[model samples]
Target: MDISIVLNLHDEAEYVSKTLESLEQAMVYAVKRGVQIELIVVIDNEKDDIGTIVEQFNFSVPSKIIKVKNCSLGPSRNDGISLARGEFVAVADGDDLVSANYFYDSFVFIKKLEKNKDRVIVFPEYVMHFDRFCFITKFVDSDQFSAEDFAYFNPYP
Candidate 1:
């Protein structure tokens, strides 16, 4: 069973390199645990110069860089959703750094729940960083699934 890391990014040139590095490093750990990761990087920002860094970055992640003109996270995610070929889906922001064992742990947990066969949606405990503080925010066990919960926000120009 494979997983798709739907990385949604806009003009994140400032911090994308570091994010990519962290993801690449995490992929190494995830792979060692027998997880096949497919990176769906949606570049809603610029594509031309983004390649300069993307190509130079050394990572073995099987990535398909989708360069969209001017799309928001909703459209970007929808686009990726259309082509997703994995059994499960996970999302990460452009600036956020995911844990090295994110995929490893998720895969194991999902397989354990025989009852919840395909309802494996485990978002990580967010590593929030404020002005001079940092902490983790865990995913809330949903009370219910409403359309508003996953509703699309305003689009980009």
Candidate 2:
């Protein structure tokens, strides 16, 4: 597989469907661009309807749902990543929605970095925050920020 999207779910029954739908669109877009993709959803809460929600979604790529008991986001994400078979891995939250071109755009950027590819991390250039308040934040390239800047503020949303 070229890319594996690991999505962490924790009691996000209200948003999981939309998130999965958005991810499916992204997967389809990437696949059309010749990027093989798979999805791994890690549910940290067994008591919620997240699993059922995920099962109802029609994913375009190979997908799996792993159940865990309250391990929180960090460990749940790690669990999903551990099972990923992709050459490149992308992380997502069950409540979030990404652009349809997200994976394809990232793939194009990664292909540009032919040397030291393993040392690079890809992040979206812009993030749209919603719900209570709405705002759009732009992220610069990693080299533009110093270590101290990261310590004081989060460059990536």
Candidate 3:
């Protein structure tokens, strides 16, 4: 199955290249696993040069840069999704770095499952910074589906 990574960005000129490089690594891993993936970078701010930076990245799969007037996260992501042509959509932040094997691992797990549109799977993330600090956070386990836990969790903006 093909996947589209909707990467949202604001004024991230300094970090765009690094983030995109990390994403490229994930895409390479996905390709090696026999999964197709594309990138749709949404520059939320019209004046941001993040789009220009995205142009420098060499991607094996389809990739595009979109600039939007609406700077909000939700709308920016919505705009990216509108241009997506993949069966599965993965939301990523421009400044965030994911593991190199993220896309490959996720696709492998998903491809083995039965088709169920209602099922949603989320992988845990670790927040990190250049200052050498990291916060590993867990949202849910395979066997744990607690409504009360989800009710209080605000995992995304």
Candidate 4:
């Protein structure tokens, strides 16, 4: 597999369906571009209906569901990442929705960096925040920031 998306969830039953739909669209776009993709869903809350929502959704790529009692996002993400079989792995939240071109565009960018691809990390150029606050922010490329910049703030989220 070329990419494995690890989606971590904790009591996000209300939003899992939309998230899955967005992911499926992105997966289809990536597959059409000849990028192999897989999805790994980690459910940290067994009391919720997130698992049922995931099971009912149709995915275009190979997908796996992992139920865990970790209760913490960090460990839940770790569990999903551990099962990833792709050359590249992406971490996603159950309540987040990504653009349909996210995966395809990312793979195109990675292919351009023929030599240092392994050392690079790709982040969305624009992040749209909603619900509590509504705004969109454009992130600076890695080369645009210095090491000292990280000491003050994080450029990647």
CA deviation > 4 Å runs, candidate 3: 115-118, 125-134, 142-145, 149-157
Q: Which stretches of candidate 4 lie over 4 Å from their true place?
A: 116-118
Residues 34-100 of candidate 3: C-alpha lDDT, one tens digit per residue: 8888889888875556666777778777888877889699999999999888888888886778889
- Among all candidates shown, the one with the greatest lDDT: 4
Worst 10 residues of 1 by lDDT: 148-157
What value does the lDDT take at residue 99 in candidate 3?
A: 88
How many clashes (backbone atoms < 3 Å, residues ≥3 apart in a chain or on different chains) does model 2 have? 0
Over 36-115, each residue of candidate 2 has an lDDT whose tens digit, in order, gives 99999898966577788888888889999989875678888899999999988999997788999999999877878846
Q: How far is candidate 2 from the true structure (C-alpha RMSD, Å)?
A: 1.7
Model 1 bad stretches (over 4 Å): 47-49, 114-118, 130-138, 143-157
Candidate 2 segments exceeding 4 Å error: 116-118
Ordered from best to worst lDDT, the candidate numbers read 4, 2, 3, 1
For residues 42-122, what per-residue lDDT tens digits would candidate 1 score against the true structure? Answer: 778674466567657766767777777656789888777666777778787767787788788887788787456556567
What's the residue-level lDDT of 147 in candidate 3? Answer: 56
Estimated TM-score for each candidate? 0.77, 0.91, 0.82, 0.90
Give the alpha carbon lDDT tens digit for every residue of 48-90 in model 4.
7778888888887999998999878898899999999998898
Comparing 2 and 3 on TM-score, the stronger one:
2
Quick one: ranking by TM-score, best first?
A: 2, 4, 3, 1
Total backbone collisions for each predicted model:
0, 0, 0, 0
